[model samples]
Target: MNSLAALLDWYATLTPASLDRIAQFYAADAHFRDPFNDVHGVPAIATVFRHMFAHTEAPRFEIAERIEQGEQAFVTWTFHFGLRGRAYAVAGGSHLRFGADGRVIMHRDYWDAAEELWQQLPVLGPPVRWLRKRFRAA
Candidate 1:
């Protein structure tokens, strides 16, 4: 299977137990960045998902779209999880580049924390919504 196919399969079915396979999918010195994390190497990258599994309830990724060209690809997905008994779906996308070895060398995720996370909080939601509406074009 191709790297993108294998990577997406791994991610779509990711579990804490499957995390050890990180090395197979990413380069030894791979870089991973997201709204809340910026880490390098297999161990550090694994820790990010470890923290995710520990802190979130039933966290999962559902791939919505994928585009590949040469050694790079971009995939759009929705991260689903529950916090404080509330379920949230965060729409995000990652830009990935593969090394010559076919392992991902860089993974950068793009998403708006303010709109996707902060605005989903019960207490913070109201104010955030207000601020967005106040500045939004009608």
Candidate 2:
């Protein structure tokens, strides 16, 4: 299989026990950034996932769409998880650059915390909804 397919498959099946294999997919000095975290290296990247495992229940990612050309790729995905028995799914995308060795050298994720996460909360939801409506043309 191609490296991109292999990487996506690994992410689809990622579990705490499989974190040790992070080095196989990411370069030694890879950089990663997302809405809440910006980190470097495979170890730091693994720590982010470790924290996710600790804070959320049954967290998993599903790839929805992908595009690749040359050394760069972008993928849209949905992160599914549960919090206090409530299930949630957040849609987002990532831009990745691969190294000559086929491992990812840079990864950046794009998602809105307010719209995707905080807007799900009781207090934050109302205000977020209000602000969105406040800006809408209608």
Error of 1 at 73 (Å): 0.1
How many clashes show up per model? 0, 0
The model with the greatest lDDT is: 1
Q: What would the C-alpha RMSD of candidate 2 be, to one decimal place? A: 1.5
Cα lDDT of model 2 by residue, 1-138, tens digit: 228888999899999998889999999999999999999999899999999999999999999999999998999999999988889899999999999999999999999887898889777889998888899898
Pull out the clashing pairs in model 1: none
| Alpha-carbon runs more than 4 Å astray in model 2 | none
Q: Candidate 1: lDDT over CA atoms?
A: 0.94
> RMSD of each candidate?
1.2, 1.5
lDDT of each: 0.94, 0.92
TM-score of each: 0.96, 0.94
